[model samples]
Target: MATITSAAPAATSDDRFFMRMAIVIAFTIVAGFALNFAMGRSTIAARPLVHVHGLVFMGWVILFLTQVRLATGGSLAQHRRLGRIAAGWVCVLVVMGLAITVDVTMRGGTPFFFLPQHFLIANPMTMLCFVALTTAAIRMRRRSDWHKRLNLCATISIIGPGVGRLLPLPLMVPYSFDIVIFVSLLFPAAGMIHDWRQSGQVHRAWVWGALAIFLIVPTSQIIARSPVGDMIYAAVTQGHPGEKVPGLEFPPSPMPE
Candidate 1:
């Protein structure tokens, strides 16, 4: 009876914490994109592929919020069913993410603040991080503590694009990628703090997840500046407008109207 009583509250507290975190993340993504659209940074005139990518990403956010609700609401049976679907969704998400990265870079549409090489490398690396963490979450689903925390981290990993949109990337210039990464880490950092406060120790899953995000930024930059990065960028942009755009150099700021 004592164990049951104590465990009940801890579990309830965790559910509430995760639920809140999910809502915040969802809001961040939606607000970032909506703000971009409002500012004319995004457009309805974008190619069909871009539109499909947007829809796919928005679908994942909705699905993520739904999963959190089901789990916190004690609908584990339904949550697991959705979990199976989410596993497949991650694959589609990754494909679309990589596809859009290549599509934009080929069109010379890579963000002005990012080196084309860095944008190409970083986006895919971020997706890979999400895939690895999410795979771990699914495999350890029976360990609810590890499972939920890993899922949160996985979602947090990919929010850099959304976070980037919320910031003044033009003003950020050389350090925009680094600043976006630092802001994104705040989500998982909050998770770590919450875990510490609740249990007197931070969970190892949070540590690993945060570390993955931390390492990927520098690692991607290093590769983007290396010979291998040159070869990959050259191959991808062969005979295209992007080839004339220096892979390692940031594109010039557009002239104000």
Candidate 2:
């Protein structure tokens, strides 16, 4: 009885910590996009596809916050039921994310700081990583600690878009994508540190999940600079406006504001 009583407080504390982390991540995403809109970098006037993409992406953030609240509020059955809806939602996110990347690239809308080829390849790779981590978290749902950490990491995976918007990416040039990816890791890194302080060791899920997210940096560079990547890029941009823009080189920066 004493052991149960002692452990309950710790579990409650952990739940609060994770709930806080989820809010921070969701805010980072919302703030990033909001920053872009404030600077005239994004708009509702974008194409229909872009509007759909934004709505779907925002939907995931909302659903994640809902799940975190549901779980923390001790509504596990509600959490699990909503988790099923989230599963389908992520699939839509992946598809919309990739489709928009392709659409933007073909239209020569790839950000000036990013090589079109790298942008094309990296977005899909990141989406795949998100799916992989999320799937693992769902599978480990019975293991609450593993489930929460993995899901948190998975959500972190998609924040690159948000983080990039917040950074002076044009100034970063060749390293912009990698830098955004690295900064995004801080969220999971914080979780690892918190776990170590509270439990005397970091969880294995954080190590593996962070590794998966971090690898996108070098893996994206290697593939984007490779012959196979060139072929894929050429095939994608052939006869399109993107063809006029070099896949391996950054586009000319917009004039100073």
| Candidate of highest lDDT | 2
Supply candidate 2's per-residue lDDT for 78. 94
List TM-scores for all candidates, in order.
0.97, 0.97
TM-score for candidate 2: 0.97
Q: Which candidate leads the pack in TM-score? A: 2
lDDT of 1: 0.90
Tell me how far the alpha carbon of residue 36 in candidate 1 is from the true structure, in angstroms, after superposition: 0.3
lDDT of 1 by residue, 60-119 (tens): 999999999998885889999988889899999999999999988888878888999999
Look at candidate 2 and tell me the lDDT of residue 243.
86
- Per-candidate Cα lDDT values, in order, are 0.90, 0.92
Error at 165, model 1, angstroms? 1.0
**Global fold similarity of model 1 (TM-score):** 0.97
How well is each residue in 114-211 modelled by candidate 2, as lDDT tens digits?
88899989998899899999999999999988998999999999999899888988889888999999999999899988998888999999999999
